[model samples]
Target: MISKLNLENILFLDIETVPETAHYSDLDPTKQALWDAKSRYQRKEEYSAEEFYDRAGIWAEFGKIVCISVGYIKMEGEVRQFRVTSFYGDEVKILNDFKTLLNTHYQEQKYLLCAHNGKEFDFPYIARRMIIHHIELPNKLDLFGKKPWEVPHLDTLELWKFGDYKTYTSLKLLTNVLGIPSPKDDIDGSEVYDVYYKTKEIERIVVYCEKDTIAVAQIFLRLRGDQLLQEHEIIHV
Candidate 1:
Protein backbone atom coordinates (compact mmCIF):
# COMPACT_ATOMS: atom_id res chain seq x y z
CA MET A 1 0.00 0.00 0.00
CA ILE A 2 2.88 2.37 0.79
CA SER A 3 4.37 1.81 -2.62
CA LYS A 4 1.12 2.86 -4.24
CA LEU A 5 0.97 6.20 -2.47
CA ASN A 6 2.36 9.43 -3.89
CA LEU A 7 5.33 10.77 -2.02
CA GLU A 8 4.47 14.38 -2.75
CA ASN A 9 1.12 14.00 -1.08
CA ILE A 10 2.67 13.42 2.33
CA LEU A 11 4.09 16.00 4.70
CA PHE A 12 6.91 14.75 6.91
CA LEU A 13 7.11 16.51 10.24
CA ASP A 14 8.91 16.61 13.61
CA ILE A 15 8.50 18.84 16.65
CA GLU A 16 10.73 20.10 19.46
CA THR A 17 9.09 20.95 22.76
CA VAL A 18 10.08 22.18 26.19
CA PRO A 19 8.47 22.28 29.60
CA GLU A 20 6.00 25.17 29.87
CA THR A 21 8.28 26.66 32.48
CA ALA A 22 11.98 26.29 33.11
CA HIS A 23 11.48 24.79 36.56
CA TYR A 24 8.82 23.11 38.65
CA SER A 25 8.78 26.02 41.09
CA ASP A 26 7.88 28.35 38.25
CA LEU A 27 4.39 26.86 38.14
CA ASP A 28 1.62 28.14 40.38
CA PRO A 29 0.71 26.11 43.45
CA THR A 30 -2.30 24.58 41.72
CA LYS A 31 -0.35 23.60 38.60
CA GLN A 32 2.53 22.27 40.65
CA ALA A 33 0.21 20.03 42.66
CA LEU A 34 -1.54 18.94 39.50
CA TRP A 35 1.79 18.11 37.92
CA ASP A 36 2.71 16.09 40.97
CA ALA A 37 -0.44 14.04 40.54
CA LYS A 38 0.01 13.78 36.78
CA SER A 39 3.55 12.47 37.02
CA ARG A 40 3.17 10.32 40.11
CA TYR A 41 2.73 7.05 38.26
CA GLN A 42 5.62 7.69 35.90
CA ARG A 43 7.77 8.89 38.81
CA LYS A 44 7.02 5.86 40.97
CA GLU A 45 9.13 5.99 44.16
CA GLU A 46 12.41 6.87 42.50
CA TYR A 47 11.92 10.51 41.57
CA SER A 48 9.82 13.38 42.86
CA ALA A 49 7.67 15.50 40.56
CA GLU A 50 10.28 18.27 40.71
CA GLU A 51 12.95 15.85 39.56
CA PHE A 52 10.65 14.63 36.81
CA TYR A 53 9.91 18.12 35.54
CA ASP A 54 12.45 17.83 32.76
CA ARG A 55 10.18 15.28 31.08
CA ALA A 56 7.14 17.51 31.30
CA GLY A 57 7.54 18.39 27.63
CA ILE A 58 6.34 14.92 26.77
CA TRP A 59 2.86 15.90 27.90
CA ALA A 60 0.85 18.38 25.85
CA GLU A 61 -0.71 20.20 28.82
CA PHE A 62 2.63 20.69 30.54
CA GLY A 63 4.70 21.65 27.53
CA LYS A 64 4.81 24.10 24.64
CA ILE A 65 6.07 23.41 21.16
CA VAL A 66 9.26 25.26 20.33
CA CYS A 67 9.70 24.10 16.75
CA ILE A 68 7.86 22.27 13.99
CA SER A 69 9.90 21.24 10.95
CA VAL A 70 8.20 19.82 7.89
CA GLY A 71 9.50 18.26 4.69
CA TYR A 72 8.02 16.99 1.44
CA ILE A 73 9.31 15.49 -1.76
CA LYS A 74 9.34 17.90 -4.70
CA MET A 75 9.65 16.30 -8.08
CA GLU A 76 11.01 18.52 -10.78
CA GLY A 77 11.43 16.66 -14.03
CA GLU A 78 13.77 13.77 -13.22
CA VAL A 79 15.06 15.40 -10.01
CA ARG A 80 13.82 14.41 -6.60
CA GLN A 81 14.28 17.23 -4.11
CA PHE A 82 13.32 17.14 -0.44
CA ARG A 83 12.43 20.68 0.70
CA VAL A 84 12.41 21.42 4.41
CA THR A 85 11.14 24.37 6.42
CA SER A 86 10.34 25.17 10.04
CA PHE A 87 7.84 27.12 12.13
CA TYR A 88 9.34 28.22 15.44
CA GLY A 89 9.64 30.98 18.04
CA ASP A 90 6.40 31.89 19.90
CA GLU A 91 4.28 28.81 20.57
CA VAL A 92 1.03 30.30 19.29
CA LYS A 93 2.69 31.57 16.14
CA ILE A 94 4.21 28.18 15.48
CA LEU A 95 0.82 26.52 15.65
CA ASN A 96 -0.80 29.22 13.55
CA ASP A 97 1.80 29.04 10.82
CA PHE A 98 1.58 25.27 10.71
CA LYS A 99 -2.18 25.52 10.48
CA THR A 100 -1.86 27.88 7.57
CA LEU A 101 0.42 25.43 5.80
CA LEU A 102 -2.06 22.65 6.25
CA ASN A 103 -5.09 24.68 5.24
CA THR A 104 -3.53 26.32 2.20
CA HIS A 105 -1.58 23.46 0.77
CA TYR A 106 -2.22 19.95 2.07
CA GLN A 107 -5.93 19.97 2.86
CA GLU A 108 -6.87 17.47 0.20
CA GLN A 109 -8.36 14.12 1.09
CA LYS A 110 -5.37 12.36 -0.40
CA TYR A 111 -2.75 14.15 1.68
CA LEU A 112 -1.20 12.77 4.86
CA LEU A 113 1.09 13.88 7.66
CA CYS A 114 3.93 11.55 8.61
CA ALA A 115 6.39 11.46 11.50
CA HIS A 116 8.69 8.98 13.18
CA ASN A 117 6.21 8.12 15.94
CA GLY A 118 3.65 10.72 14.96
CA LYS A 119 0.61 8.68 15.83
CA GLU A 120 1.89 8.37 19.39
CA PHE A 121 3.72 11.68 19.78
CA ASP A 122 4.10 14.43 17.18
CA PHE A 123 0.62 14.28 15.61
CA PRO A 124 -1.43 14.30 18.80
CA TYR A 125 0.93 16.71 20.52
CA ILE A 126 0.42 19.23 17.73
CA ALA A 127 -3.36 18.74 17.87
CA ARG A 128 -3.56 19.24 21.63
CA ARG A 129 -1.28 22.24 21.51
CA MET A 130 -3.38 23.81 18.76
CA ILE A 131 -6.53 23.32 20.82
CA ILE A 132 -4.83 24.79 23.88
CA HIS A 133 -4.07 27.91 21.87
CA HIS A 134 -7.62 28.09 20.45
CA ILE A 135 -6.54 27.44 16.89
CA GLU A 136 -8.87 25.53 14.59
CA LEU A 137 -7.39 22.21 13.56
CA PRO A 138 -6.60 21.87 9.86
CA ASN A 139 -8.32 19.02 8.09
CA LYS A 140 -5.33 16.72 8.34
CA LEU A 141 -5.02 17.13 12.12
CA ASP A 142 -8.76 17.18 12.86
CA LEU A 143 -9.51 13.59 13.80
CA PHE A 144 -12.43 14.25 16.12
CA GLY A 145 -14.96 11.77 14.78
CA LYS A 146 -13.46 10.18 11.67
CA LYS A 147 -13.46 6.46 11.27
CA PRO A 148 -10.15 4.63 11.69
CA TRP A 149 -9.71 4.20 7.94
CA GLU A 150 -10.65 7.83 7.30
CA VAL A 151 -7.53 9.00 9.15
CA PRO A 152 -4.76 10.47 7.04
CA HIS A 153 -1.56 10.17 9.02
CA LEU A 154 1.39 7.83 9.08
CA ASP A 155 3.94 6.80 11.69
CA THR A 156 7.27 5.28 10.73
CA LEU A 157 7.44 3.60 14.11
CA GLU A 158 4.06 1.96 13.56
CA LEU A 159 4.98 0.92 10.03
CA TRP A 160 8.07 -0.77 11.32
CA LYS A 161 6.07 -2.49 14.02
CA PHE A 162 4.03 -4.43 11.41
CA GLY A 163 1.47 -5.63 13.96
CA ASP A 164 3.87 -6.19 16.86
CA TYR A 165 3.06 -3.46 19.38
CA LYS A 166 5.05 -4.77 22.33
CA THR A 167 8.35 -3.04 21.66
CA TYR A 168 8.75 0.71 21.33
CA THR A 169 11.34 1.91 18.85
CA SER A 170 13.10 5.24 18.99
CA LEU A 171 13.71 7.17 15.76
CA LYS A 172 17.47 6.95 16.26
CA LEU A 173 17.41 3.18 16.65
CA LEU A 174 15.08 2.70 13.69
CA THR A 175 17.27 4.83 11.45
CA ASN A 176 20.32 2.86 12.53
CA VAL A 177 18.70 -0.51 11.80
CA LEU A 178 17.09 0.72 8.56
CA GLY A 179 20.46 2.08 7.33
CA ILE A 180 19.24 5.70 7.19
CA PRO A 181 21.61 8.37 8.50
CA SER A 182 21.20 9.14 12.19
CA PRO A 183 19.65 12.52 13.01
CA LYS A 184 20.95 12.55 16.61
CA ASP A 185 24.60 13.45 16.03
CA ASP A 186 23.92 16.68 17.89
CA ILE A 187 21.61 17.13 20.91
CA ASP A 188 19.03 14.44 21.59
CA GLY A 189 15.50 14.63 23.01
CA SER A 190 16.84 14.77 26.56
CA GLU A 191 18.82 17.95 25.92
CA VAL A 192 16.14 19.81 23.91
CA TYR A 193 14.74 21.37 27.09
CA ASP A 194 18.12 22.69 28.14
CA VAL A 195 19.01 23.82 24.67
CA TYR A 196 15.79 25.76 24.21
CA TYR A 197 15.44 27.11 27.75
CA LYS A 198 19.03 27.65 28.87
CA THR A 199 21.07 28.32 25.75
CA LYS A 200 18.26 29.74 23.58
CA GLU A 201 19.80 27.89 20.64
CA ILE A 202 16.66 27.59 18.59
CA GLU A 203 18.48 27.32 15.24
CA ARG A 204 20.46 24.37 16.59
CA ILE A 205 17.24 22.60 17.59
CA VAL A 206 15.69 23.52 14.25
CA VAL A 207 18.48 21.82 12.39
CA TYR A 208 18.10 18.73 14.53
CA CYS A 209 14.35 18.79 14.03
CA GLU A 210 14.72 19.13 10.26
CA LYS A 211 17.09 16.21 10.15
CA ASP A 212 14.50 14.09 11.90
CA THR A 213 11.89 15.19 9.35
CA ILE A 214 14.15 14.18 6.51
CA ALA A 215 14.90 10.91 8.23
CA VAL A 216 11.18 10.17 8.50
CA ALA A 217 10.79 10.79 4.78
CA GLN A 218 13.73 8.56 4.05
CA ILE A 219 12.24 5.81 6.17
CA PHE A 220 9.02 6.04 4.20
CA LEU A 221 10.94 5.73 0.95
CA ARG A 222 12.96 2.81 2.31
CA LEU A 223 9.77 1.03 3.33
CA ARG A 224 8.56 1.40 -0.24
CA GLY A 225 11.81 -0.11 -1.60
CA ASP A 226 13.08 3.22 -2.94
CA GLN A 227 16.58 4.65 -2.77
CA LEU A 228 17.66 6.83 0.13
CA LEU A 229 17.95 10.56 -0.53
CA GLN A 230 21.43 11.82 -1.30
CA GLU A 231 23.04 14.71 0.60
CA HIS A 232 22.66 17.10 -2.34
CA GLU A 233 18.99 16.26 -2.70
CA ILE A 234 17.88 17.74 0.62
CA ILE A 235 17.29 21.50 0.82
CA HIS A 236 16.57 23.81 3.76
CA VAL A 237 14.35 26.82 3.24
Candidate 2:
Protein backbone atom coordinates (compact mmCIF):
# COMPACT_ATOMS: atom_id res chain seq x y z
CA MET A 1 0.00 0.00 0.00
CA ILE A 2 2.85 2.35 0.78
CA SER A 3 4.44 1.84 -2.59
CA LYS A 4 1.14 2.24 -4.42
CA LEU A 5 0.26 5.56 -2.82
CA ASN A 6 0.41 8.78 -4.84
CA LEU A 7 2.47 11.17 -2.68
CA GLU A 8 0.50 14.20 -3.83
CA ASN A 9 -2.73 12.65 -2.56
CA ILE A 10 -1.45 12.44 0.99
CA LEU A 11 -1.67 15.44 3.28
CA PHE A 12 1.09 15.04 5.84
CA LEU A 13 0.42 16.88 9.09
CA ASP A 14 1.63 17.50 12.68
CA ILE A 15 0.04 19.39 15.56
CA GLU A 16 1.30 21.37 18.57
CA THR A 17 -0.79 21.57 21.71
CA VAL A 18 -0.53 23.20 25.11
CA PRO A 19 -2.44 22.87 28.33
CA GLU A 20 -5.80 24.65 28.11
CA THR A 21 -4.45 27.30 30.40
CA ALA A 22 -0.97 28.54 31.29
CA HIS A 23 -1.25 27.38 34.89
CA TYR A 24 -3.23 24.77 36.72
CA SER A 25 -4.63 27.51 38.93
CA ASP A 26 -6.21 29.10 35.93
CA LEU A 27 -8.71 26.23 35.64
CA ASP A 28 -11.98 26.53 37.54
CA PRO A 29 -12.25 24.63 40.82
CA THR A 30 -14.45 22.00 39.21
CA LYS A 31 -11.99 21.43 36.37
CA GLN A 32 -9.12 21.38 38.83
CA ALA A 33 -10.77 18.57 40.76
CA LEU A 34 -11.45 16.69 37.54
CA TRP A 35 -7.84 17.05 36.47
CA ASP A 36 -6.63 15.86 39.82
CA ALA A 37 -8.74 12.73 39.59
CA LYS A 38 -7.90 12.17 35.95
CA SER A 39 -4.17 12.32 36.46
CA ARG A 40 -3.93 10.27 39.64
CA TYR A 41 -2.63 7.10 38.04
CA GLN A 42 -0.22 8.86 35.73
CA ARG A 43 1.06 11.05 38.53
CA LYS A 44 1.64 8.07 40.82
CA GLU A 45 2.46 10.21 43.84
CA GLU A 46 5.52 11.56 42.05
CA TYR A 47 3.79 14.80 41.16
CA SER A 48 0.60 16.56 42.13
CA ALA A 49 -1.98 17.64 39.56
CA GLU A 50 -0.53 21.12 39.57
CA GLU A 51 2.96 19.75 39.00
CA PHE A 52 1.75 17.43 36.25
CA TYR A 53 -0.18 20.14 34.44
CA ASP A 54 2.74 20.75 32.12
CA ARG A 55 2.06 17.44 30.44
CA ALA A 56 -1.65 18.12 29.96
CA GLY A 57 -1.29 18.78 26.24
CA ILE A 58 -1.05 15.05 25.62
CA TRP A 59 -4.60 14.62 26.83
CA ALA A 60 -7.38 15.81 24.52
CA GLU A 61 -9.76 16.64 27.38
CA PHE A 62 -7.47 19.06 29.15
CA GLY A 63 -5.43 20.56 26.35
CA LYS A 64 -5.99 22.61 23.22
CA ILE A 65 -4.24 22.57 19.90
CA VAL A 66 -2.27 25.72 19.11
CA CYS A 67 -1.00 24.72 15.73
CA ILE A 68 -1.82 22.27 12.96
CA SER A 69 0.75 22.20 10.18
CA VAL A 70 0.13 20.30 6.99
CA GLY A 71 2.20 19.54 3.94
CA TYR A 72 1.71 17.85 0.57
CA ILE A 73 4.10 16.80 -2.13
CA LYS A 74 4.01 18.64 -5.44
CA MET A 75 6.02 17.97 -8.59
CA GLU A 76 7.63 21.07 -10.01
CA GLY A 77 9.73 20.65 -13.13
CA GLU A 78 12.37 18.06 -12.07
CA VAL A 79 12.02 18.54 -8.32
CA ARG A 80 9.60 17.21 -5.73
CA GLN A 81 8.48 20.14 -3.62
CA PHE A 82 6.85 19.64 -0.25
CA ARG A 83 4.62 22.62 0.51
CA VAL A 84 3.62 23.35 4.12
CA THR A 85 0.97 25.61 5.69
CA SER A 86 -0.27 26.06 9.22
CA PHE A 87 -3.59 26.95 10.91
CA TYR A 88 -3.04 28.33 14.37
CA GLY A 89 -4.35 30.51 17.23
CA ASP A 90 -7.67 30.27 19.09
CA GLU A 91 -8.41 26.55 19.10
CA VAL A 92 -11.80 26.98 17.51
CA LYS A 93 -10.47 29.22 14.80
CA ILE A 94 -7.56 26.89 14.13
CA LEU A 95 -9.86 23.89 13.88
CA ASN A 96 -12.33 25.74 11.65
CA ASP A 97 -9.55 26.85 9.29
CA PHE A 98 -8.11 23.36 9.14
CA LYS A 99 -11.54 21.93 8.40
CA THR A 100 -11.93 24.49 5.66
CA LEU A 101 -8.67 23.34 4.11
CA LEU A 102 -9.82 19.75 4.23
CA ASN A 103 -13.27 20.54 2.88
CA THR A 104 -11.84 22.64 0.11
CA HIS A 105 -8.99 20.48 -1.14
CA TYR A 106 -8.96 17.02 0.46
CA GLN A 107 -12.59 16.01 0.20
CA GLU A 108 -11.89 12.99 -1.98
CA GLN A 109 -11.74 9.25 -1.42
CA LYS A 110 -8.23 9.06 -2.81
CA TYR A 111 -6.86 11.68 -0.44
CA LEU A 112 -5.25 10.41 2.78
CA LEU A 113 -4.11 12.08 6.00
CA CYS A 114 -0.61 11.08 7.19
CA ALA A 115 1.21 11.80 10.40
CA HIS A 116 3.59 10.25 12.88
CA ASN A 117 1.65 8.41 15.64
CA GLY A 118 -1.37 10.11 14.13
CA LYS A 119 -3.80 7.27 14.77
CA GLU A 120 -3.25 7.46 18.51
CA PHE A 121 -2.51 11.14 18.95
CA ASP A 122 -2.89 13.69 16.17
CA PHE A 123 -5.92 12.15 14.45
CA PRO A 124 -8.04 11.53 17.52
CA TYR A 125 -6.93 14.75 19.17
CA ILE A 126 -8.18 16.75 16.20
CA ALA A 127 -11.49 14.85 16.15
CA ARG A 128 -12.02 15.21 19.87
CA ARG A 129 -11.17 18.90 19.80
CA MET A 130 -13.52 19.46 16.88
CA ILE A 131 -16.30 17.87 18.81
CA ILE A 132 -15.52 20.01 21.82
CA HIS A 133 -15.65 23.11 19.65
CA HIS A 134 -18.87 22.05 17.92
CA ILE A 135 -17.13 22.00 14.53
CA GLU A 136 -18.24 19.46 11.93
CA LEU A 137 -15.78 16.70 11.29
CA PRO A 138 -14.48 16.45 7.76
CA ASN A 139 -15.17 13.26 5.80
CA LYS A 140 -11.57 12.12 6.13
CA LEU A 141 -11.62 12.62 9.91
CA ASP A 142 -15.07 11.26 10.75
CA LEU A 143 -14.49 7.50 11.14
CA PHE A 144 -17.86 6.35 12.51
CA GLY A 145 -18.92 3.61 10.09
CA LYS A 146 -15.84 3.08 7.92
CA LYS A 147 -14.27 -0.33 7.93
CA PRO A 148 -10.73 -0.58 9.32
CA TRP A 149 -9.18 -0.95 5.87
CA GLU A 150 -11.31 1.86 4.47
CA VAL A 151 -9.89 4.51 6.77
CA PRO A 152 -7.90 6.93 4.58
CA HIS A 153 -5.04 7.71 6.93
CA LEU A 154 -1.35 6.81 7.23
CA ASP A 155 0.76 6.72 10.37
CA THR A 156 4.55 6.55 10.14
CA LEU A 157 4.85 5.35 13.74
CA GLU A 158 2.45 2.51 12.95
CA LEU A 159 4.44 1.69 9.82
CA TRP A 160 7.64 1.44 11.88
CA LYS A 161 6.00 -0.74 14.50
CA PHE A 162 5.70 -3.62 12.00
CA GLY A 163 3.37 -5.54 14.34
CA ASP A 164 5.63 -5.25 17.35
CA TYR A 165 3.03 -3.69 19.60
CA LYS A 166 5.26 -3.47 22.65
CA THR A 167 7.79 -1.10 21.22
CA TYR A 168 7.35 2.62 20.55
CA THR A 169 9.47 4.82 18.35
CA SER A 170 9.74 8.61 18.46
CA LEU A 171 9.85 10.59 15.22
CA LYS A 172 13.21 11.99 16.26
CA LEU A 173 14.72 8.52 16.60
CA LEU A 174 13.19 7.24 13.38
CA THR A 175 14.35 10.26 11.41
CA ASN A 176 17.84 9.82 12.83
CA VAL A 177 17.97 6.21 11.66
CA LEU A 178 16.53 7.19 8.27
CA GLY A 179 19.16 9.97 7.84
CA ILE A 180 16.61 12.74 7.82
CA PRO A 181 17.63 15.95 9.56
CA SER A 182 16.49 16.32 13.16
CA PRO A 183 13.38 18.44 13.61
CA LYS A 184 14.21 19.06 17.29
CA ASP A 185 17.17 21.37 16.75
CA ASP A 186 15.30 24.42 17.97
CA ILE A 187 12.94 23.10 20.66
CA ASP A 188 11.38 19.74 21.45
CA GLY A 189 7.75 18.95 22.28
CA SER A 190 8.37 19.37 25.98
CA GLU A 191 9.29 23.02 25.51
CA VAL A 192 6.28 23.93 23.40
CA TYR A 193 4.09 24.82 26.34
CA ASP A 194 6.69 27.16 27.74
CA VAL A 195 7.34 28.75 24.38
CA TYR A 196 3.63 29.24 23.87
CA TYR A 197 2.49 30.47 27.28
CA LYS A 198 5.65 32.20 28.39
CA THR A 199 7.39 33.51 25.33
CA LYS A 200 4.23 33.85 23.26
CA GLU A 201 6.22 32.63 20.25
CA ILE A 202 3.52 30.76 18.37
CA GLU A 203 5.49 31.20 15.16
CA ARG A 204 8.30 29.14 16.65
CA ILE A 205 5.82 26.40 17.44
CA VAL A 206 4.44 26.67 13.90
CA VAL A 207 7.94 26.21 12.50
CA TYR A 208 8.49 23.18 14.68
CA CYS A 209 5.17 21.70 13.69
CA GLU A 210 5.93 22.26 9.99
CA LYS A 211 9.34 20.60 10.33
CA ASP A 212 7.74 17.55 11.93
CA THR A 213 5.21 17.34 9.09
CA ILE A 214 8.05 17.55 6.58
CA ALA A 215 9.96 14.89 8.48
CA VAL A 216 6.91 12.63 8.43
CA ALA A 217 6.75 13.05 4.63
CA GLN A 218 10.48 12.40 4.28
CA ILE A 219 10.23 9.33 6.46
CA PHE A 220 7.39 8.05 4.33
CA LEU A 221 9.51 8.59 1.24
CA ARG A 222 12.43 6.76 2.80
CA LEU A 223 10.15 3.87 3.73
CA ARG A 224 9.11 3.81 0.08
CA GLY A 225 12.80 3.49 -0.85
CA ASP A 226 12.88 6.98 -2.34
CA GLN A 227 15.47 9.70 -1.81
CA LEU A 228 14.98 12.14 1.06
CA LEU A 229 14.05 15.66 0.01
CA GLN A 230 16.70 18.33 -0.15
CA GLU A 231 16.36 21.51 1.95
CA HIS A 232 15.82 23.56 -1.20
CA GLU A 233 13.01 21.21 -2.19
CA ILE A 234 10.82 22.16 0.78
CA ILE A 235 8.49 25.10 0.08
CA HIS A 236 6.69 26.83 2.97
CA VAL A 237 3.24 27.96 1.93
Candidate 1's residue-wise lDDT over 154-178, tens digit each? 9999999999989999989989999
Clash count, candidate 1: 0
Residue 40 error for model 2, in Å?
A: 0.7
Q: Give one digit per residue, the lDDT tens place, for model 2 in 1-237.
A: 699988889999999999999999999999999999999999999999999999999999999999999999999677788899999989999999999999999999999999999999999999999999899899999999999999999999999988889988999999999899999999999999999999999989999999999999999999999989898988998
In terms of lDDT, the poorest run of 10 residues in model 1 is: 135-144
Scored by lDDT, model 2 comes in at 0.95
Query: What TM-score should be assigned to candidate 1?
Result: 0.99
Off by over 4 Å in 1: none
After superposing all C-alphas onto the true structure, candidate 1 shows an RMSD in angstroms of 0.7
Which candidate should be chosen as best, given lDDT against the real structure?
2
lDDT of 1 at 187: 90
Off by over 4 Å in 2: none
